[model samples]
Target: MPCRWLLAPGKALRTRFARPLRCDVNNSRRMLSFLSSMSPDNAELRAEVARTRLSVAVGCITEVRGADAIVNCANEHLVGTQLPYINLDGAAGCVFHCVDGVVHKRAGPELHEACMSLAIEEGSYTETWGGIRCPSGQARVTPAFSLPHCAHIVHVVGPPWPSDAEELRDAYSAGIKAALAVEGPEARPAIRSLAVPAISSGIYQWPRDMSWAAAVQSLGGHLLEASLRRGGAGELPCPQDGARSGLDHVIFSAWDAASGREVEECLRRWVDGTLTEDGLL
Candidate 1:
């Protein structure tokens, strides 16, 4: 599939600072500042900008209520972390333990093979969850088990960053594709997938700003495109179009409160006129 790119307008503001003159060394006088002449309320705008930027960076992870299924960032082994030991041990242990019994009972040997095969073809199933041994080491996908609400847990490895910018863009695009691909007779009515921060910034060591930019751009593009497809204005095939089609809703999960707020604000801005050009809301 051809990759889609969405660009958001820049909102950077520039501030100027006065330079000290060497000739004034003997003078104990200071030049009057224009900033002081302005209303003290101006500082509020600067503070608001700072707050907004921080919110944007943190991103969001929502529960996606009423979704068919929620995707978890899994470990490679597919054994979720055990609970009770979660806080002390970390996410891996918690996830492993949470779904271990359920997954082990249902995963079976065939499922394992299928997962391995998919992992081989698509890098790691969940790109944001695992780590690489070194800069040049091969990537690993985090493992996750299936739950009852969703028919299938579609695992895909998002591309590592600092590489081809276009390819990185495609990874986000592919995630939507994966979600769409699961729309068959046996699929659920509303499919929801959770996305992490992606592989570049965390253990993968990709720059945070760049990674975030790519994620927002790609996800926003796909969502808009999907909407268009469903509306019948676009040529793209949407699973929801078919009779008895088992597809509804696409959800992106943010990892923390700050991140969640960022996504929410972005979506709100996109929905309103503030961020209309970005096609994200």
Candidate 2:
């Protein structure tokens, strides 16, 4: 389902989603509790979420490893290209580049050449996110080629801030689905988890509140849909086997405290179904 902003007065946000994966407050709480008890990979996020209750679907992280994929908030220039160098030789997960945060530069030299092969000139890329379909809201997925610790890289272009407000959710959700859609068990190590950033926050200048809300809602809604059923190979990994949707364990990486706090509160409201016009961060 395309990400819809479906809010009605007095109705819980959980139920407002396309599907009802969050059963009830009891279920939400239970799921939230379950997140905390997972393996070491998720321990910190579990603890963080418990203390803050900011988001049941979103996790804030300082470092990433073992995730099926990680998000890079790029720009037209793919700014902030720096990804952590853990093990360059280790074939790791995937990295979803949202915006143009120069992740390719850091991934390795040949990474840029691979992106060029996708043929997304700035004009076409911007046009796509602006609502025209060169396949609107779609992403170009490619093998990471030489980026260490990642097997593939999904590049997504979010709408230019202040212009395509409605498209942010599309960009976020598309980036994620594309990552999971990558065919092959050879891509296994990182297909089950994903990482993203606060798209449109920097040079794009999106208010921190909008960034988190769009992100969390997209994630929560997607997870619910996957858990309710199963779509094909392109589907985001859901705990259909009773594990968890790789999409559910989202990481909203922030560079500042203000953005961090906003994501937390915004995510909390989304989970609680309390986010409203008056409750914006």
Candidate 3:
């Protein structure tokens, strides 16, 4: 299938940081074919995978609307730390360079309070970091107050750069798990769509390529596992399965056009089997 790209109008993301949001979608037969070839015996699984839409986009995650939940790359302390030394030229003097800071800033102080409450519930305090709320590779969920679009936000802490790749993968997986488990009000529907940023790809310094690849692999594996369980492959029945209905979309977001292009390329490779269980080809 030929690759196609769509760039959302700049005005949409201009509420705070004005910039164009570029999105790349691939509803390719190649991806379905790969899934079919991998699971010839499980037609249901292949169909389920085909129904789920995965995309890569370039945009400020705070401006992403319509997602049932968005994932935040949070630190262990859940505090939005300001790195005054690092300056993003186009950030409009927004000292919040990291995603964690950006999210906290946009979402208001309420988010900070919620995170602290969540930390207390989890009993994850530690002296090493002066009371860590969420340890590395862990995830927590909170209401997206002040940010009216999404119902919830999943805060995830990833391992530092050049660390255990498995741990990074776990952080992505944990975010998905936390998002799936969110139980919103009766008027609100189950989380059927999620927007995720490249965890540990920024100030933490994990290579963007490696971070996105791990994200894709983890989410793909999750959908596959969910399909298996839903198809009666003999795994424990997921209780939230009925509530969720199923995740219809998972968007991987990049902060800028260059990174967005990189994410799209990575996704394209995954669809064609160039990026696989072992690593990128």
Candidate 4:
């Protein structure tokens, strides 16, 4: 379970006359997004992370492709947002609150209609979804309907501020598991690739440092679980063991540079045997 985040600088973020070298911070103030991929530093880090089995990327969610599934960080109501953003510096840029709108919009209207129908009409049978509204820190799996590349979508509701870090971690884990469900009895998971965003990093104001750390933990667990399912409990798993898993990729796509860098470091440290002693989360 390697998570990838993709980030880029804000569109309106220009060098200020007074602080010509501080455009990064200036951009952070406008809206949260994946912003570091295009930057030289981020570009290098992205390449470095890719060398590892588990990794993170900084980029736009809409721009992602080849995933068998994608995650939608939804609210309890599972509704979408306008993904609005106003440039504090120049009144431009589109910051996002949730990825639901972007996923559904690109997937086409049928995707939204399916969600609405499930909430308002049929309701879900999953233990996680209690009727129309999904609970916080839980995930529910659904068909993509019109999303051409993805066969499924995992909708997870991240909790607001003040919730336990464990809760946030659980939310991510659930989403990943749901996204990697098997098609039928005795079948491997239908999803081979998956994409996720920074859950609860926006209006929820979840701490970026710990939240991203939790993300790493969740993905780590995902790989471990895959190993256990395929190879059993006694043996340790190699990166190649991941081939038995339904997922070939688990990308944590981002729109901001900070998250991208943070997740990349997490993967790097873990691979280098540093996370065990350094205590990242």
Candidate that scores best on lDDT: 3
Query: What are the TM-scores, per candidate, against the unseen true structure?
Result: 0.44, 0.57, 0.69, 0.62
Which digits, one per residue and each the tens of the lDDT, describe model 2 over residues 32-148? 643432334533443344243223223332234444555655434332333232123344422433234345555665765655444444445443233222243566666655445
Model 4 spans > 4 angstroms off: 1-52, 82-97, 119-131, 146-148, 182-186, 228-246, 272-281
Clash total of candidate 2: 20
Deviating ranges (above 4 Å) for candidate 3: 1-52, 82-96, 120-130, 185-189, 227-240, 243-246, 276-281
lDDT of 3 by residue, 67-100 (tens): 8888998877776653232344444334446678
Clash count for each candidate, listed in order shown: 23, 20, 0, 25
lDDT of 4 at 280: 48
Q: Please report, as a residue range, the 10-residue window in candidate 1 with the lowest summed lDDT.
A: 29-38
Q: Go through the candidates in order and give the C-alpha RMSD of each one to the true structure.
A: 17.0, 13.1, 11.4, 12.9
Query: What is the alpha-carbon lDDT of model 2 when measured against the actual structure?
Result: 0.50
lDDT of 4 by residue, 18-104 (tens): 212234663463112222222333433333333533545576665667677777877665545532222324433324434676676
Q: Which 10 successive residues of model 3 have the least lDDT summed?
A: 13-22
Report how far residue 102 has shifted in candidate 1, in Å: 14
lDDT of 1 by residue, 38-105 (tens): 22433343233223222232322222343444333233333333323333445433332222233433
Best by TM-score: 3
Against the true structure, candidate 4 has what lDDT? 0.58
